[model samples]
Target: MSSTGPLQPLTEGGVKHAIVGTLEQITIALAITVPLGLACAVFLNEVPGGYARFVRTIVEAMTALPSIVAGLFIYATVILILGLEKSGFAAALALSVMMLPIIIRAADVVIRLVPSSLREASYALGAGQWRTVWTVVLPTARSGLTTAVILGTARGIGETSPVLLTAGFTAGLNTNPLSGPQTSLPLATFSLVGSPQPALIARGFGAAALLLALVVLLFVLARAIGGRGPGELSRGQQHRRVLASQRDVVRMSARRPVPEPAAPDPADS
Candidate 1:
């Protein structure tokens, strides 16, 4: 091998492609999982009765499922039934299944945190159940929705076994998830650690660091973007709050009696 070969381990082009492919897989998985998970959370939180309980039970059980089992299920259903080859898309779909329960649970907890008073106020204004939920409940819990998405993405990015069983690690660039083999950081690390080369081993550590950095960066970005900054609101709310404060001040001012002239005290001027 050329001296340059070890310097630029795993084909500089290959490493770049791997990073891109892994990002694509994670994005796709989150795209599917987030909406589905949010909907599940909404349903579970809003609907009453045994049916909702049953659905929640099913979702909770799914959270405990092994990653390999999810991978095998996808391998059987998508790959085998449809005769699709191993691909990043299939792997992302499997990872989305794995992430769904976590997203749903996180979202559900946040939705539940919404105060009952908010719902009462919405109803008092003649808003329907769905409208109240969409407008008031979700806006109140936007931070949690973002957090759930981050959790799902973190779980999806580092999953090795499922991606291995579905998306085989290939060296070349694969932009098309539907057709070509895709390499991820997890796959790269696994491959390098299994090899005997010291340089390759070091590269694996670099890859791990890169993955960790991506997760942390995404979490910070999500939190930054998730909610309205503190106290920022529509003009109406601001006006109402200002009015309430003024009314309180006026009420306190009116209630205070003029201090009667104090009786003359010794040595007072």
Candidate 2:
């Protein structure tokens, strides 16, 4: 790998920095987005509050949020205002913002598609609202949720503008995303392909191809993992559920009241 950032010769430059940077950024971004998105989706689907409509509208608008604006927002608030350096972490924040709405909106639609009958059955069994949502609603929407997550990943992974604005280019690998500049595959590809040299252009295309392959691989893996029908648990999940039920039984047994000894058969005495 070249020691110089994005200015090294085609012979000296390596893709390792870009690969590591891309993975780090996406990992951080997904970590930030997924839980929040799912919570928001659940709220929108389960609650019919007036504020929910406003939140839904905001999410819908954000789904169309421009990449440059995302970049600019981070650049202004994070880099400029917060005094953080241009680094992978900053870029990840921008990516998370771009991804959050897509995931929330998609997941909300998927959860809404779940049958009302399942929820009714759950309630009839004396399950609480949260319990029904946890055990019934989410499981039924598993495949669609997976698809939603994959769609958000696909959207954020290929973004060059955010990375460029926040993650300053680096030729050498930077493992610590908390500090220092980083370069993602898309940013590297954009830089290389813009050069007049045919070799750099070809390398850029190769990087692009690799990125495409990674995205497709992620989609396939997600589909395989989430392919089961509604309420169908994997063996591991079944085992855990069994263990949980056993614990519940033990707990109830411990809480059972002792019967008072029969003191009143004294008529015979």
Name the best candidate (by lDDT).
Answer: 2
lDDT of 1 by residue, 1-269 (tens): 11335456555433576698798898889889988999999999999789999999999999999999999999999899988999999999989989999899988987888888989999999999999989999988887788778877887888888898899877667889888788888888787667677777777777888888888887787666454432235567789999999999999999999998979988876
Q: Please give the CA lDDT of all the candidate structures.
A: 0.83, 0.88
List runs of model 1 lying over 4 Å from the truth.
1-14, 219-269
TM-score for all predictions? Answer: 0.79, 0.80
Error of 1 at 43 (Å): 0.1
Candidate 1 vs. truth: CA RMSD? 7.6
Top TM-score prediction, candidate number: 2
What tens-digit string does per-residue lDDT give for candidate 2 at 1-269? 56533455566666888999999999999999999999999999889889999999999999888999999999999999999999999999999989999899888988988889999999999999999999999988888888889888988999989889999987678898999999899998888789787767777888899988988887787777656655567788899999999999999999999898978687788
